[model samples]
Target chain A: MNVIEARHLWKEYGDNVVLENVSLAVKAGEFITVVGTSGCGKTTFLKLLLGVETATRGDLLLDGKPLPDEPNADRGIVFQRYSVFPHLNVLENVMLGAELAASPFWGRTFGKRRRAIREQAVAMLESVGLGTALLKYPSELSGGMQQRLALAQALIKKPRILLLDEPFGALDPGIRADMHQLILSIWRQTGLTIFMITHDLKEGFYLGTRLWVFDKRRHDPQAPNRFGATITYDIPLGHTDRTTLHTIQQSLGANHD
Target chain B: MKRLINQRPSRAAQVLLGILPFALLLLAYLWASELRLAANPNDKLLPAFSSIGEAIWSMAFEADKRSGNYLLWVDTLASLQRLGLGVLLSALMGLVIGVANGAVPLFRAGLSPLVMALSLIPPMAILPVLFIVFGLGEVSKVALITIGIAPFLIRDMQQRVLELPEEQLIKAQTLGASSWQLILRVILPQVLPRLLDAVRLSLGSAWLFLIAAEAIAATEGLGYRIFLVRRYLSMDVILPYVLWITLLAFLTDYLLRVLTRRSFPWYYNGGKP
Candidate 1:
């Protein structure tokens, strides 16, 4: 069964439309990445999925239930700009989710609950290669490390699903590639489902099992007709092997047809 | 980053720096005894640094024959009582009002302008009005300090709390942190350092106001002592008292800086943004 399913999802901003008639589904533990140009409403889609924003119309389902209106520990999010709390040390940032997430037994308890969860945070940080840097502040670290911390913050809670909004889009090419690989490794180890949004097709091809493309029709008649904002294609997990990669590369060289 | 340029020198260096100016003054005062002997070195008028120290050692510290140790003790107790009451009342009232105004949009819009105006008007300017309402009693001085300082603390608390990042708030709420939990764990921790600074700032300002406060219609206070000496044209007493006040202010500011550093180390060391 699909872990996440959306039917005729519509997101509108005043008069302009961001995403319309966007429907998609993902199997459990699938690594899906949504790719599009700058204004493609990809970020909006991720926000909607993470419950940071609401859909204008249509139904959003999470494991067959109605989408929650706000964020939940069941789904963790990482943003392009690192969301690592600048005031909290790495360990605290990671454990904060669990402490505040309200486990049945941990409720009505404070410091005692955190002590146990802190060990979990350290192990998770160790998994992310941040064992030595767990006490360091985000400002003291480099950008790539901060992203790693953000990833660690999201992962430590052991959320069943993770949502990333261009987590590597802001990094340099080398770091971005490293982050992509690290994310893949973590997903494999933790078996957490991921849905990432990015504009880089190469990244989408490399890391994503499933991919969606957003396009917007231009207002200028003189220019090629394309979406100013809309999703154009949604491709499957096995859709991108060597030949499909070549096809996307060739298609890029040929120009928008 | 690039070596912080010793913004705060070591404690020894600070002590050395503080004493150096006095040393120079002492040398000058002693040198004047040779050829430039200012006619009368103990001229109750100019009370040199050494004389002021001697005078302070005589008056503020000396036994009060009339009030029996009672004069000094009573002044100290009275000042402490007024200060403690005013600060406590202001902190409690300030945090509540500040949090309310900061958190609520309508209240912030409607009342912030008034708070801003209150903060701008000098408390000394209206000292006479306060005296008229509360009279020259302990109530007048404490009330004056409370109203005079609470707005700034309230505004500081309000702005700092309000400025807490929306992303963190949303993150906490998503984690199921109730409103009270959010304030205790998230908002208060973030706002506290700034709140402490505001309190200290208001306290120092109130200390200055205290002297002006006690200068009128009262029998005893640090300020009253200073005012009484001024009436007698006794620079010996006035000079020493002024030095005491200066030293007190310096020590208080230093203590506050150290306390803040110790309490809110998170503030000094960068943490989760």
Candidate 2:
């Protein structure tokens, strides 16, 4: 079944149409990475999927139903920055989703239940290689560690779909590669649907089972925003290996630049 | 990251750097007092340090014959009570009004402009109005301080709440946080440090209002004593009271800074809100 389906989605802010006629049917457990030029509405598409913003027109469905009007547990997202709660430590950050889901209004659950949640959070942190830093604040973590915390914070909620908007865009190349591997492994283990947007052509090709390119095919100088970006290219990477796709796309993307 | 170039001063130098100006000012005052005393056997304007010390000792230790209370301690307690009550009330009101103004458009539309106008009105200008409404008692004084400071605090808190990154709020909602849950767990914790910082910033104005109200009308308070001594040209008492107020304000600010650093280390260290 398609976990997320967008049919002729349209988003506009005032006169600026961001995404127009964008359509997709994303299956469960698929790693879909999107690459686009800056201001090509890639992030806007993610926001639509995350339901932070409603579409100006068209329909987006999650599980073949209308997309949620606002953000909900069905979808989780990690931004490039400020994703984790800085007030909470590593463990508390991961545990917040459960706590909010359970005893959201007041004091946290006590006794065995609280301990059980803590253990679960610790295990989640351990899986993200952040078990040792459970007591540390987000500020104390390095750039890489903080992003890992962001991942753990999102993953702990067990959302059906995870949306990432350039989660590792700020990291160095080495750390970004490591995060790429970590995310791929998590996707494999959990069989979770993943949608990510990146400016790096190579990273996009290396990770996703399918690739989407968003761009405006026609631009009018008199009315530059007359056409919004759409999924101009949707390529399935089932047979192409990462290296081969990267090499070919590197040249193609270089030209598209 | 670029290496931090400047080296910290040695411990001894740091201490000396802090004390040198204060020591110089004290020496200057002592020298001026000596010249005055030589010119006149008893000059009330700049009484000898010993005379100020003696006045403090008497007021602090000796019971007043009329009131049967140690005037200095009584004044300190009264002043502290008024200041504490006013500030506490302002903080609570600010949190509520500010959060509402920030999080709810209806609340913001109804209250924000009015708050801005109230903040612009000089707090001292409303002293008579407060006195007329609440009468010449502790209520009037506390009300004066609260009204004088609360508006500013509210605006500070409102701006802080509004400035919170949009991503954090969205992320919380996605985690299945209800609107109230998002506020209590996410917004409140982040805005708390900013609240304390605002209180620290507003302390000066709070003290200003407290003293203005007390000086105008009060039976016993630090400001009352200072103003009362002015009639008899008792600089000895007045100087000591002024120093005491400064010391109290400094200590409060220092304590708040330490508390913010200790309890919300991420706030200062991360520089995020």
Candidate 3:
């Protein structure tokens, strides 16, 4: 069964339409990569799926049920900047999910439950290779470590659908490659449906089982606001290799990076 | 000694540099006082330092003949009480209004402009209104300070909360946090440091309002004592009171800085994780 189903989704802010007629079905365990130019509504689409934003038209269904109005534990997102709470340490950050679930307010879990939650958080931090930095604050970590902390924070909640908005966009190429490998392995082990948006076509093609390209195809320069970005290309990358995608990119002859 | 521009000096040198201006000011004041006192042994505008010292000893240590109260201590306690109450109430109001302004669009739209407009009004100008409404009591003075400083504090807190990245809020919500949970866990903790910062900044104005309120109508306060002594030109007593108030203000600021630093080390670390 498809974990996510968006049927002709439309998003508009006042008269300016940001996204129009974006429809896609995302099955469980599929790594979906969305690649488009800046201002092509990729992030907006992710926001829509995460329920940070509402569609102006059409429906989005999760497991054949209507998506919730607000964000929930079932869907998690990691931004490029890594949205780890600055006030929390590595352990507290990873434990935040269970803490929030156990006690929504004050973030205080006490007694045996607290001990259990701490153990879970500690295990999660260990899994992310942040065991030594357990007491360290986010500012004490490097960019790659911070992103790992962010991933641990999201994954600790055991989300069914994980969304990444260029989570590796800020890392060095080598670190980004390492993160790509880690994320792919995690995806394999967890079998969570992942939707990622990126500007780097190579990175997108390298990781995704399915690729989506967003663009405003019917753009009139005089009144460009009239047209909204739509998913122009949907390519299933399960069989097609990177070389084939690169050739297709050359044929397009545009800045697909 | 060679002085390097922009380079930090040694600890002793830094202390010397900090005290240099104060030393010069004191030297100038003493020189003028000596000249005046030499000419006329009873100049009251700037009394000799010895007389001022004597006044401090007596006012701070000894009880008043008529009222049987150590005037300086009494005044300090009264003024500190008023200032503390005012600031505490202002902080509470600012946190609530500011968070509401940041989190709720309806609340922000309705009240933000009103707060901005209220903040623009000279707080001193409405002193009479507060006195009339609250009466010439501690409530009036405390209320005056609260009204004077709370709006600016609220605005500052609102801006800080608003500037928080949208992703943090969304991420918290996705982690199964409700609106209340998001605020209590996410927004409150982050904005708290900024609130402390804003409070420290607003304290200067709070002191201004407090002194103004007390000076205009009070039987016993630092401001009242200062103004009361001004009539007799008792610079000896007045000068010490002014210094004490300044010392108190400085101590409050320093304590708040230390508290924020100790309580939220992550806040001071620029929120890296």
Candidate 4:
């Protein structure tokens, strides 16, 4: 059964259409990676899935029901930067999701419940290689460590779906490689569905079970807003040949440069 | 050859440079006072340092003949109380209104213009109205400080709240935070240090309003005492009082800085809002 399905989803800000007729269905644990040129509504589509944004004119369903218009614990997101709360130390940041979920009124837990959340948070942090930095604040961490903390913070709620918006875009190459391994292992262990947006085509191919390219199918020079981006190519990975990869890379390289 | 900007002074040199101007000013005052006192046996304009010291000693240690109260301590206590209450109330109101205005569009549309208008009005101009409405008492003096600084605090906090990254809010929501939870857990912790900063920035104006209100109506306060002695041309008492108020203001600012550093170490280490 599909965990998420969008039926002709449309999102427009007045005359400026962002995503038009975007429709897709994702099985429960598919790893979908999206790549597009800047301003091509890749992030907007992710926001729609995360429920921070609503489809302007169509249905976005989760588990066969219309997705909530606001974010909830069923889905979690990580941004490229400012994903970790600067005020919270690493352990508190990871514990915050469960704290809010368990105690909605005060956003806190006490004694035994608090102890359990702490242990859970510690385990999550350890999984993300942040166990040693539990007491350190976000500002004290390097960019890579902060992203690890962000992932731990988001995953503590055990969301079925994780949304990552260029979460490793700012990392050094060596650090990003390590992060890619960490994320892949976590995904394999938990069977969590993931939708990641990346600017790097190579990263998309390496990480995703399926890849999507968002591009404008039609253009009007005089009325630029008249046309919106749609999924130009949806390719299943694992069996994709090098010639196809080269063609897609050549087509996207011009815009990227 | 080093550029001017690159030629920073050594530690000792920096300390020397800092004291130079103050030393010069003190010498100038002493010279002028000596000349005035030599020409006239009793010059009221600038008293000798010894006279000022004596005034401080008496006001601080000796009780008043009629009221039997140490005027300096009484005045300090009264002024501190009013300042504390005014600032506390302003901080509370500013945090609530500013967060609401920044986070909720409806609140922003309704209250932002009124806050802006309140901020623009010269607070002193409304002194008469405050005195009339609240009466000539402690309430009026406290209200003056609150009215004088609260709008500015609110506006500053609102801007700080607005300056927070949009991703943080969305990230908090995805973590299953309600709107109230978002404000309490996410927004409030971040805004708190900025609020402290805003309060520190507004302290100068807060002091100005406090003195103005006390001068106009109060019987006992730093401002009241200074103005009361002005009629007699009592430069000794007045100068000491002014110095004392300056010292108090400096100490308050220093304490707040220490508090921010101790409580929210992340604020200083992180990027500016």
Q: What tens digits encode model 3's per-residue C-alpha lDDT throughout A172-228? A: 999998888888888998998999998898888778889888887676677767878
* Residue A42 in model 1: lDDT: 83
**Candidate 1, A68-137: lDDT as tens digits:** 8888777777777637666677777777777766544333335777677888889888888889988876
The TM-score, computed over Cα atoms with residue i paired to residue i, of candidate 1 is: 0.80
Query: In model 2 chain B, where is the ten-residue run with the lowest total lDDT?
Result: B1-10
lDDT of 4 at B239: 93
Query: What is candidate 2's DockQ?
Result: 0.65
- What 10-residue stretch in candidate 1 chain B is worst by lDDT? B33-42
Give one digit per residue, the lDDT tens place, for model 2 in A1-257.
88899888999999999999888899999999998888889988998888878999999999999988899989988999989888888999998999887796763577888888899999999999998999998888888999999899999999999999999999999999899889989998999999999988778876889988888877777887888998877888767666766555654465346
TM-score of 4: 0.97
Q: Considering every candidate listed, which one attains the maximal DockQ?
A: 3
What ordering of candidates by lDDT runs from best to worst?
Answer: 4, 2, 3, 1
In the range B1-273, model 3's lDDT, one tens digit per residue, is 446675787899999999999999999999999999999998898898889999999998998999999999899999999999999999998999999899878899999999999999998999999889989999999999999999998998899889888888888887888878888888889889889999999999999999999889999999999999899999999998999999999999999999999999998777545
Output the number of the lDDT-best candidate: 4
List chain A TM-scores, every candidate, in order: 0.85, 0.93, 0.93, 0.96
Tens digits of lDDT, candidate 4, A1-257? 78998899999999999999988999988999999888999999998888878889989988899988888888889899989898988999999999998998889899999999999999999999998999998888999999999999888888879999999999999999999999999899889999999999889987889999988788787888898899988999888788877878876665446
The candidate, 1 or 2, that scores higher on DockQ is 2
Between candidates 1 and 3, which one is better according to DockQ? Answer: 3
Worst window of 10 by summed lDDT in candidate 4 chain A: A248-257
Candidate with top TM-score is 4
Residue B61 of model 4: what lDDT? 100
